[model samples]
Target chain A: MKENKCCCSKKQKKLKVVNIGLQTFAESLRAQGVTVAQVNWRPPRKLDSEMKNILDDLL
Target chain B: MPVKKVTVQQNRYADSVTLMGILDAVKKSGKVMLAEVQMGTPQNVEVMRKLGFDIPATVNANDLVIALEAQTNELLDEAYKDVIDRLDRKHTDGEETFNSIDEVDPADGWNLCQISLPGEYAAEEAKKAINKGLDVFIFSDNVSIDEELQLKRLGDEKDVLVMGPDCGVGMLDGVALATMSLVREGPVGIVGASGSGAQEVACIVEKAGSGISALIGTGGRDLYPQIGGLSMIKGIKRLCEDDQTKVIVLVSKLADRAVMDKVLTFADGVKKPVVAIFLGADESLFASHKVHGTFSLEGAALKALELCGISCKDFEISDEKIKGIVDSYMKKFSPQQKYLRGVYCGGTFAEESLIYLKEHNPDSQLYFNMATKYARKLDSHLKSQCHTLVDLGSEEFTIDAPHPVFDPELRLKRFRQEAQDPETAVILLDFITAPGVHEDPISPFAKACAEAIKARGGALAVIASICGSVNDPQDIVKCGKELVDAGVILTGSNHQSTLLASAFMKALDNRK
Candidate 1:
């Protein structure tokens, strides 16, 4: 749906992972010498359909 | 008297993984005897209530609940503040953190996203990652089927891989992801719907002197008709086109009849040698197709090894050797001990053992927590019935806390329970060692086994297999040694361990 801005041309490089929701997966990858960005993901607050639509339009 | 307190944070929610970490930290402070940090889901509220916490009736699923017990109200308050502090702590030990996928800037060469959030939120995050051209490996479970279909469809249209809504084990470009062991890079690639099934095969392949090019997990439901084996087909095609992968192995429990046909037909077209293990499927299903079909994990591993031009005769124990081992164990059993109980942390291992035991002893009644055609469902997972195989990784066991692979307390308790049963002649177990699991999962269970054997006057037999490699962080060789030193019979593979347990059961039946 969006342009692939994250695509890397180098295929032989070490894998880069963005681990969301569970720091352990990121830690495990980092322990193995892989490059990882840990995301401290928490559940989003509840929004009704009308509020969600407004937010979606605003964003 | 210990004081118990329940505090609910309205509209504040964290993933179970994060809550588990907070729970551990609070308990380790030694200020609280009983502490639980969980979302206020019905099941979690029920668990807290059972633990003697008085949760408010107004608490809802979106709310965060922290229950604590301590010697005094002061101690309880201190521990409660510690949990809140940990929750408010933003940075995780100097590692860079992002609030959402939008902040992750894909140009940093981030090619993949591994999501382990709660099921309700997993799909939206996965959609964001996929839209950003990042391949996804989801470890979260409980996502609705409609959400899974929508995500897979989006992934298909985007051409980026979607690994799972409940996917656990995976390895890409020589890096183990999620709960997978660190397997060496080599010729074999796997497309599996079952996490533990693929892990077993990968470990067995490594033990057979072969290695893996990739291990792609398609979650547990990808092969159902609703999903149409979307991820599995994509994975098979990707492995087929990859230069490093010379052989492809497909592993899963039996899918819908039409879906199985569709997948095998697709695999049949691939030029590379393919091995399929549709557990409980008749062997004849593969006779018509060019792809090889196997019924057991070991059989699938050996077949893939053979296709790779590797001789794995040493990996297989002769029937005579199995008989000798069985005879030795049978002599130690008392006249009253007759049944076998398998307490497994890996679900696939339990299913494999249940299938094997049922095949050999068709007349014997078998029970499992997960219902199968051959085995009836256990009345209660907390208590093992005769000839029971329990998958402690199932949702029933994992709803309150982390998986048994990460915390062995549940399996250990079940092991002790089964060990004390007078009718349990053989107790079967499977231990998985990987990046994210417990450091030494075998020793505590081994110690418990030793005590149980001593208590039984050496009349009990404990048989187990470890699914890991020498490259894992845990000392696997030492783990095996711990089991042996504790009078536990250790096997090289889960299949062999199950076979030995089955043989012991058959022998006990004959003696009766």
Candidate 2:
């Protein structure tokens, strides 16, 4: 529900990140009442660029 | 108790002219403390012996240098290790009474297993994990494909998951109990060919207002030609099939193009858009629902978000965006330039530069080395290029050393020679910075680059990519500011540097 101005322009918008990280990060998300899902998989085979994007989406 | 002179310039002695007179004065001085003298440089050490001073038998110049560096590194390792060791001990010590199935029973706590056991023993390790009903993380890389296939199957049968055979880094939930950051609850699934690659990707995602579903380190083996992404395919498929995953991004330092093609083919069928970034791949061949061609490791992360429709508020200042903007800007700067001379620290970035140039002007000769042992070893299409992807790691260029990251002086000198040549119009450089990186990377890199640009009289636009960690105290932004201030427009990552340098060539062609 928090709002901030967009960097692209000056329009204000809600800040959001669904759930991020494991325990503490998850707890923070839950405190904000964000729904969380546990994903079971090995880390990405490519660890540099694309991996971060996937992580960003999850957040 | 005497401190050794390690500086480049030798300490000044009074102009008494005689070495003995200086030694006599040294001995006469009430402040002279005779503990041990550490002779620093090979040149200085030789001069010291000629002066007839009885240098210690134990303190040779090489030994002193080695000891100093090793001691410093050892101390740092110990400090970080102390943190990890204490945390791991606490997690282990508390496990006797902790509750919950998702959580490791405090009694059965801290199953930190080394994965280098022989095949039979490895199977036994998997069996033990199942018997204890523990979550397994594997960190060894020498295990064969067959061994991995067996171990993975066993974990599945036991209804528990195994992390890696060569896996070193992952964050399970939010407990960075094992790795530095342990685990946080986020939606990103990270896969990498290199261990450091995984670590870097995770750090960036964390910095950019996101977290990870899981950060998987597949050891370098999964991307090698023999395995061809089979395990990686499994890992990716699992993430993509998961209802929790909104996006899957793949990162790797190096991979076979054919294997990458197969992975992409599979990716094309996924409901979630995949961001496939293959390092050193020609941009012309990038084919995916959402493909990002990047040379440096960080570019893949930025492009993945862009492809996923999650625009960063500051993507403009992000490394990739900056490189794109600067490349376009440079394209406008010089419209008549033809040939380019690129000096890059990273091997993969160098190849991408050549690829970008060819795309712009196929007729203009592009020179670099992609050093594959034989012609038949390479795909026919890749064989046509003369640009050598000179692995700075190889002993040929990395003479008298184990690491290329430590020594950039050799390449900087060669870059200067290339700049003086009349045919060279532009210089592209891939400069990287990170912890335990080259000494004075920004200044030395900028100095060499400025010299080249000045020699060409502003015709040469030096484009650079800073590949250091975002969390690094001295990250790419600071490095870029320094480079930009020095008259060289620093691109964010290697991919952008290549693209911008190539775009400049394209702009030149349009003028002609």
**Which candidate wins on lDDT?**
1
Evaluate candidate 1 and give its CAPRI docking class based on DockQ. Answer: acceptable
How many collisions between residues are there in candidate 1? 0
RMSD of each: 4.5, 15.7
Candidate 2 local lDDT, B1-512, one digit each (tens): 22322222122111111222333433343333321123244654565555444344433322321111112444434333433343234224321312212333314233322233323334444445544544455553456677666666565554444556656455433333123232234556666655445555555555455656655455566666666676566557657645445566777655777777777777777777666556546566574434445644556666555655566556334446545654555554444345555665565455455545565567654545443421111133212222222334434556554345556767666566656655555566666454344645677767776766676666666666665544443565677777887678665455556666656565554556
Model 1 misses residue B73 by how many Å?
Answer: 14
lDDT of 1 by residue, B366-434 (tens): 899876787999898788777888999988999886789989998899899898888998889999998
**Poorest lDDT segment (10 consecutive residues) of candidate 1 chain B:** B90-99
CA displacement after TM-score superposition, residue A27 of candidate 2 (Å): 27
